[model samples]
Target: MEKSLIKPFIAKRVAQEFTDGMVVNLGIGLPVLCTSFLPEGIHVTVHSELGIVGQGPAPDEANADPMHIVDAGGSPSSIVAGGAFTDSAESFGLIRGGHVDAVVLGGLEVDQEGGLANWIIPGKRMPGMGGAMDLLVGAKKVIVAMEHTAKGNPKILKKCRLPYTAINCVNMIVTEMGVMDVTPEGIVLREYNPEFTVEQIQAATEAELIISPDLKPMA
Candidate 1:
């Protein structure tokens, strides 16, 4: 697939995991794109750590509210009808209180033990580990949505080198190359992109993968 098509492909696959009436939190970056690919007839209440609930998609510049409503990433966003806004305290309360069903997060690295490292790279100036720790442990499910590699370096590793955001917290992973579930046995390959064979996908991953008996094409 063309490089330009990868993110959306991963996003579409992540969106498929959501079901009706689920309250989901979308972390900054790639995870936010899942909103654009949600399947029809499935409605999910999107939560932003910035305090917006029932958040909608990015709006056309001309249609955007002059008040500057934005998501947790600070991107201008729209709120669906019946959506309500709350203070950040209340938002964190909801998350820490386990009101969220699932959270989709972007990762820099994920290891065999379901560890994630995304907040920062050592010595690289970063804002902070915004709400990731809370969501990782608070949400019912944690899904990491990211690319298979970074500049040709594998992001899925035998053990994450960077600082972990949460240990043993990830449940599923969706990348342009494949879909995997982090299991006690190991990383299990569930669906793979037909563009790459099983061997090719394994070559791009540093962690060992257990091929699922029901493995099929990603799309």
Candidate 2:
């Protein structure tokens, strides 16, 4: 698949993990795209650390209320009916208090043991670790959604090279190349992109993968 199509493909697959009435939080960038691909008839109440709950979709740029409604990334967004805006403290309380069902976060690297390192790269200036640390531990399920590789370098590895945001916190990983479950034995390849062979996928990942007997094509 073309590079341009990868993010959305990964997002669509991640969206499949959400069920109706789930309260999900999406990290900035790629993770936020999952909102655009949720399965039909599913009603997920999206949360934004920026203090919005029941978050809706991005609005038409021409009609967007930029100053009043925006996601954590500062992109214009809409709020669903009955959605309420809260103070930052209360918003974070919802996360730290474990009120969230799941959180989809973008990652720089994920390891076989489900370690996640996404907050920063060594010596690179970063604002700080945002809500990731809290969400990873507080949410019921944690999903890492990212590209399979970065400039042809595997982002999935035997062990994460960067500082971890949380250890053994990830439940699943969704990338354009496949869907993997981080399990006790290893990273299990539960679904794969039909365009690539198992060897090809393995070559793109530094972590050893255990192919599932029930492995199926990633749609």
Candidate 3:
């Protein structure tokens, strides 16, 4: 039997980090799902580098905002309150200037040293990095939410073989199996959702883990 590809799996996990009034930017593609995970009755202002701010999840079909449109990921999105549309130049300033509280980005490979490889892999045709560079540098916090593995093998590695987007930039990682915090000391086990063990997580990881003595299941 095949396993169910959980819809909004990563989205729900990313939502745990969201708080009221967070200035957030979700990377293109999967990271955009965070929009759909917003808690009702709480206002979270989302910023899209695509010249949009105060975005909400994709509008309901019947209640769809003709003017409000979501990205390709089916995430609900809208403009920020009293926001302005500016060119990429000014937009980047918001990122690099540390105005963004947290940014959720996907990754191709992430190492224990906090290096990220999300753009291109050699011998693979992929679009080059654009805003990721600025976001890595500017965002106050960075959370990388992705599947635990790639091609039956681990993408969480001891070191990244592909070219890096940034070093020591990622702060947290949420995998199908668990959550980890990247600290100067090591990758700290924060939350593990599924019924998995530290040994299982270690077996799945390419990097060494510093399991917290007080480790617990993810909420």
Quote each prediction's TM-score.
0.93, 0.93, 0.86
Candidate 1 lDDT over residue span 1-219, tens digit each: 688888888889999999999999998778888878889999899998888889988889997874769877677888899998989899989998999999999999999999999887888857688899899988999999988999999999999999888999999999989999999999999999999999999999999999999999987
> Clash number for every model?
0, 0, 9
lDDT (10s digit) by residue, model 2, range 1-219: 799999889999999999999999999889888878889999899998889999988899896999899888788988999999999999989998989999999999999999999998878857678878988988989999999999999999999999999999999999989999999999999999999999999999999999999999987
Worst 10 residues of 3 by lDDT: 1-10
Which parts of model 3 are misplaced by more than 4 Å? Answer: 1-7, 56-81
User: C-alpha displacement of 112 in model 1, angstroms?
Assistant: 0.8
Quote the lDDT for 82 in model 2: 93
Whole-structure CA lDDT of model 3: 0.79
Candidates' RMSD to native: 1.6, 1.6, 3.2
Instruction: List lDDT for all candidates, in order.
Output: 0.91, 0.92, 0.79
Model 3: per-residue Cα lDDT over 1-219, one tens digit each: 023544267678788788888899888767777777777765566777755666655656775655546542445555545766656677778888888899999998999999999988767757778778788989999999888888768889989989999999999998878889998987888777657777888888998888878788876
| Candidate 2 vs. true structure, TM-score | 0.93
